[model samples]
Target: MAATYKAPLRDIRFVLHDVLDVSRISRLPGYEDATPDIFDAVLEEAAKMCENELFPLNRPGDEEGCTFENGVVRTPRGFKEAYATFIEGGWTALATHPEYGGQGLPKTLNFVVEEMICSANLAFGMYPGLSAGAYNAIAAHASDELKARYLPKLSDGTWSGTMCLTEPHCGTDLGLIRTKAVPADDGSFRITGTKIFISAGEHDLTENIIHLVLAKLPDAPEGTRGISLFLVPKFIPDANGAPAERNGVACGAIEHKMGIKASATCVLNFDDAVGWMVGKPHRGLQAMFTMMNVARLAVGMQGLGIGEAAYQGAVAYALDRTSGRALTGTKYPDRSADPIVVHPDVRRNLMTMRALNEGARALSYWIGTEIDVSHHHPDPAVRQEADDLVQLMTPIIKAFLTDLGFDNANRGVQIYGGHGYIREHGMEQYVRDARITQLYEGTNGIQAMDLVGRKLSAGMGRLLRRFFHPADAYIAAKKSDPALKELIGPFAKAFQRLQQATAGLAQKAMANPDEAGAAASPYLRMFALVALAFMWAKMAEVATVKIAAGEDVDFHQRKLKTARFFMEQVLPEHLAAFAVAMAGAKTVMAMADDEF
Candidate 1:
């Protein structure tokens, strides 16, 4: 099997520097040290760690997977070592707050590192990924005592974490949870329940595992309002805060999954485990959202990661694998058959992958920097704007990027033809791996619903304003640029369609909520396409100005080409999406109840 991965450092830098200008993030109080030189140095080191330490282990990890026996779960070979190297390099503490012993780098840099890690080994990334989410939840909601005890360990990677939200029967519907937490004598609670699909649930990468669990209190009301968050460690800390007595939270079994096999997905049984409450009682979902929102963004990076890897693999195979000559003529007359790169169809797949990957990277990286801005900006209004942007883009990033991730992975397999179907070239694995991303962090359908139902209407459309205002300004600014007519024209028109769809859906949704539900998916796609169009137009603008200035000519030229592809070929899909979204609920609900 020839599954391969290389961190796209140049593209990452382009997004960080040229597109988003992350120096704006560094201007915030805590991120002053996040200079371009520091970013390059950190990214270069991260690329090395990903390429050398982790990428080689990806195939082997997939092959070996994880093993479970006698209440112990062991990660595949090299994972423990790779993880040691990861934490020893302070990778675990990259974006954590300095109060918790982290270096407290801006999340912009951390997001880039995260993408590289996912590209290298997604399974390996999960171990720390979950821990980071747990850290966020705890930092925001946990008591000072709990934070003092747990935050340092989680930040230092001496311990890892998991978000145990799902059970056998309930996942998205947290209101139906059966997990119960009883008040204990020692001011803690007893968490007794079974949680399934728990990623990194029982991995052996770290000394101790902390589980941020969702369970209902004895006196709590029914439904989601009754839910409470608990911190249940796999090993209870001793008086000195080291792993001591075993906690009742044990891995009953691990799930056999389609992908990310090396990342242990466990069926955990908490047998009256002593745990402490986090946040206010009956406010678990609010606190957990702190984790879920960040996880959603991180999952978007997973999609980007897979897309980049799959695209790279397809490009590699296309360049190496000889096939029929070009339709026009043979460019390489000496060879009996030209490489597949000479073919138009092959170029289409390659171009789609490249254009989407680059555009998505630019968009995601922009939001990543905004995360830093939202948290650290001195001005209240600027912070609010950044936060609004993050909220609005979260679902789009999660759903749109993952959809492309799966699409591009399949495209890789398509490009490989027969070789792709089998395990030999590893294109098949990309498909399998990409599949899970859309399913988790809320299904893309659910994401679309969140966009239409929640984010669309939140703060009286303030979230929508965050995206709409800048887009309005950009289109107005560039619509008249004759040199940019090819790029900006397509983007401006598509963006108009998006605005129309937005208003139409909001009006229809006000009349009947089901109209929103019916149009949610297409509306999200329309919004996403327009968003990407905006990014492409911005990139095209930069490429145009930079090319005219004779700076980084090759990179700018390639950027212009990809931007043109996105604007001309890709952004137009919003028209069809807009058509579908505006048609509205009646036809969709016409066949209901017992038609089947």
Candidate 2:
């Protein structure tokens, strides 16, 4: 059967309007019109597009993949048409500026729409996804002339974009990159190098492809500081800002990836491509981060989206497929066996998937609201605080969520037994596709390192406080409430463990940086669990108040139940993480080189 998806619209609304109360976004400068109704309408329409249009294409797109010949990529059947409809519907411009022909919606709304698209079709999502990141980079850092030439087309989805950072020689180490940018007499640069693993690098879906490439200038210093960003398009634009003559950039080959087969991951070669600078020279990494940070969050959504799809598949199978009888009694007396969902083990798998998915969705959307405040808020102090939260949470969202997403997809496959291993069942594909999210957009390992090394200690724990204070305040306020003690107790304990671990890691790092490196992965995981516990607590608090008022009693009850399950079952993992992190690097480094 084809992969199925029903956008979790109800939960999305609960998280946004009820839990996060995103209506506060309207108080920001440009989002005054973003009432609940507008958000509902946008989400409903985006859901229709994803469910009706993109979901059906997912299996076929995976099977067909993309075909490349003569340096041209033909997307899977229906992809171009779907993309045309997507752009024509103005979905691409939802969060862009009005001056650039965009609808100028808040990023929070865009986050929901993007999640729906990714859930429906991860491969197809990449085409527009990369463009949005490119649009952000240029809109934020590029000069007026560059933005004028690129932003409108990118914003409107008339053209697509790619960020070319990895080369054959360098993946994460920008200091090792050898791509060269030479100044020409015409005040433009000539870029020449090869970029590998460029997603949406060359495709037939759009008229042009804009590449934001990183290269080194002749007079530049050594390593990363010498690097600069350049805008090199596939087809050079005419005076009217339309594609006219071909640029020197061309696709050399496309990677045969393990998953997301429908998305073209290309190897691009630039032979003295005509390009213009973006931002100040030697500041390319700073500008590119405008895209990378957004892309990291977007990749996190990929994990959540795939997990949602997998959970749906698993739930549907569990309800329909009959297996051994229930331990207590027969759930289906009319049949010989009860559905597999009746089994404790199967229920465990399903609940684990559901708990992780819902918690991640809530955490991500909460962060999305912060993104809006960081960008559009009128107060500088509030904006700075929000930005700090974004910085602190980005790695957690990217690393922790994707790692669990892969696990959830695996659980979906396990829930289906032998049938899931086959292609037609579609559960296996989710596993394959989600695996890449952890690997790309900076490996989860790198994200963990970033969290422990850069974010945790930044500003003498000021960034950490963005998350720590609210969680601390919530626990302190609720600890005395007898009804909420079950939920709050575990969360409070975990939060305390996280604080102690943070301090412990900081002190250990002062003595030996290797201690931080050894502890970073577990430390990040522990931190992520606490952050999610905080989200679950907030959700439980909302559910508790709503239950008291007798509004949506069943929904609120379920929320409380799930929150309890997470606290009792999942949050305890923090103890193991904390213990491992506090172990330091002693045993890990005891073995000599080549001893293994």
Using lDDT as the measure, the top candidate is 2
Give the lDDT of residue 555 in candidate 2: 89
**Model 1 lDDT tens row, 29-106:** 888998888999999999999999999888788888999999899999999999999999999999998899999998
TM-score of 1: 0.99
All predictions: root-mean-square deviation over Cα? 1.0, 0.9
CA-lDDT, candidates in order: 0.91, 0.93
- Candidate 1 displacement at residue 60 in angstroms: 1.3
Candidate 2 lDDT for residue 137: 93
